[model samples]
Target: MLKKILFALIMSVFFIGIVSGCSESSDKEEGKGSGKQTVKIGYFPNLTHSATIIALEKGFFEEEFGKDVTIETKTVANGGLFMEAMATKAIDVGTTGPGPLLNFYVKNKEYHLISGAVNGGAVLVSAGSSKISDLKDLDGKKVAIPVIGSTQDVMLRKALKDVGLKPTTNGGSVELFASAPADTAALFVQKQVDAAATQEPWGYVLENQAKGKLLLNWDEFAWGKDSPNTVVAASQNFLDKKGFSASYLKAHKKAVDFIQNNPEESQELVIKHLKELTGKELSKEEVAAAFSRLEVTTNVNEEVIQEMADISKEAGYIPSADIKGLIDLSTLEEVSK
Candidate 1:
């Protein structure tokens, strides 16, 4: 059984004030005048990560971190790369999918899942001209995923298992190809891959621009809306920074609120941010559709996170499935009291 905590907007407001307040006090006490501490952040250039994007665009993180902290960022192409950056201490904390976080955590045990970023932005899509209409039609087809052990890859594998089919890694008909989500659209257009288990707005882009058809939408896929797609992960060092993790979540909560309360403005901000980050502009319709597909929240389903960890372990991507102490939401819990 997973522990579920669905935080309300007003409850989050209370949580943020309590958490960030502690972080501020701790920093002041460290008044050794060590100057400024730099916080290295990482995130994918995907709408699944719109909260983080909106935070950066709106200066939420800067506002929360205050004048004593220096913020640096890196745009990761996929969750695998994002975790890798965390491993090398290149990224102190940032947003990434649950799959890669668990896959990396099993072996590294170096990450603390601080908050949930988004849920259900992944979709299963096939070529528009292809005869495949659903998961059952995926036999003998080529599927493109962001990476071998990515969140979408795990979802695709689970869905395939349900259909009594498997990717070639398990000697099944479907062959899995690892590609960056941004580049998967070309493969879909060139007819190079039969389908993709990808995150938005690439899923949206593939449909509108590459004639890709959605076989399963975000809410209809493997775990459906229950899937915990994106989460805020903190490196070991970051968590050790007294109340830093709590402070980061304060900004995270603000971003989640901004997205939920001002979705229309969020879509435009996402459009501008993605364009600036990737130089690949997306239409408003696609961005809007993509934005609507996922749920932005700070609450996580621990059972779903556990199941994802198990799936990765079964897929031979991780050494073990025991991710004890993987999630530390005590900061949020404490402040609420």
Candidate 2:
């Protein structure tokens, strides 16, 4: 009788353990099957990221993700910060310049470029009294950029080198300062910096509000008309989740299409979103001017991006960049179809 009772208690304990294990396993499977119900998106508030801004403002992301999923958007100051956010998984996807994205990809292989966000909209601006009419004149002057190794910085450095100059950090005559575009605009307004290499609406603001001059339009820069200014990147883990990535890309495509096909409406949306993000009201004319300098699209130019990587390496921004596996346009292509 004692032995039977002991055996019965052992079996009861075993059954409980088995049931608990099954429950835990079921929970994990359910979690995996359900996937992430929320996605964190990171983007800059500048006109260069107009597609993302429009998507957020116009309900494109919500429309794509439906009411079940929650979308959280973060306005990052620069690509470097965006990359950091991605590193900690704080953001699932982000829009950033190819320069910083490439640099990040080289250091950490977890992020992938899924689509293009914007092209052009970057400019070299100088104080009105600086008389820096050309890149050559940038010699012996302090110039500000959004960041040290950003798209604008890489372009400015390469352009300066083409003009037979280099950044002071590179043992050249030109001094490079890194600051936010808004701050750069203020510095330009105060004549604290001789020039600023920046992306738009800030460029427009400097020209119109700060009385600055456009030293070099983006088209005339080293990368010329074909360069990609911003791209949509996602972590491999996020992409591996499946449904959300495709949905995000579809919404991205829609935003680009809306920008191209519905210029007037898109401009209004861009202005409204920009104002909300920056807390500074922008006029229709200013927004239009900013749009004129940019091409809102989803075309990822691989050759141009590769060239940018080369430029970044040559400029000593990155020791070397292996862009292989960095770009995965399969999702974008599938969404387009």
Candidate 3:
């Protein structure tokens, strides 16, 4: 009788262990749908990233991922650090432009473009020098840009080459310096740089506040009208294994829709978030002007991205980049449907 009771207790323990294992597996599946996976996002706190503010303020990401979703926002100094965090899986999602994204891909880092964030946010400005009006005037001139591989850099280089110039080479014509958009404006105001290419509201700040001259509005530059500026990118490993991209895209699309449908209200949200994120705010008109000049869409179309890549190459940021394969449009396509 003693032996039989001991055997029965052993069987009961075994049965409970199996049941607990099954329960744990079931919980993991439920947790994903329940928003257990933390979503980490990275971006710069700037007027150029107004879409991100719009999305966060409107709770678009939360709605798509369910009420339990947590969105952690990290503000890095520049796009290079932002992309670096994304590459290391320290960030689950990031919003940056094509130039750095392509550079990462060329280095064999795995990521996917889930959606478009903004467009037409770049411009080239001269300090107080009228001679820097056109690319020809850039000869031997010291110009500042945010970063070497940033979208602004790619476009600026392409625009320079269009006017028959190259960078970091004698007779190349222009000297490009690395500086933050806001800091670059200070350089312009101090006359330290002949010109600098950057995105708004820094451009607006320089022109409106500092008495600096606008050399080239991005639209008037090489690519013509705005090319996609910010893009929503995700890790390829995360997308393939977790299958969370569809949900993420749903959130991103919702963000674009919210921005479009509620411009004034959305502007207020962006302003509020920017103030909260950066401890400052721009005037209503400045925010409105920035919004009017920006295109917030998520269409990762091949042709447009390729144009950006071509621009990157011309700038010598990359020898070449395979942009078509870099985009995982199917994620957005499915999310849209």
Could you list the CA RMSD of all candidates, in the order they appear?
A: 14.4, 3.2, 3.7
> How much is the lDDT of residue 202 in candidate 3?
81
Candidate order, lDDT descending: 1, 2, 3
Off by over 4 Å in 1: 1-34, 335-337
lDDT of 1 by residue, 41-120 (tens): 99988788898899999998898888888889999888889988999988999999888888878887779898888999
Pairs that clash in candidate 1: 2-303
Clashing pairs in 3: none
* Candidate 2 residue-wise lDDT, 186-237, digit = tens: 7876778999888888888888878898888878765766668899999998
Q: What value of lDDT does candidate 3 attain over all alpha carbons?
A: 0.75
User: Number of the top candidate by lDDT?
Assistant: 1
Q: Please provide, for model 3 over 1-337, each residue's C-alpha lDDT reduced to its tens digit, 9 standing for 90 to 100.
A: 9999999999999999999888888877655535476778777788667766766777776777665666677877677788788877778786877777777776665876778888777778787754556668887888888988788877777778778888874347677888888787667667788887888888777788767787887577556565767888777766774546777777667778888898888888888888887788878988887776677887655676777777666566677756656887777777677
Report the error of model 1 at residue 316, Å.
0.9
Worst 10 residues of 2 by lDDT: 27-36
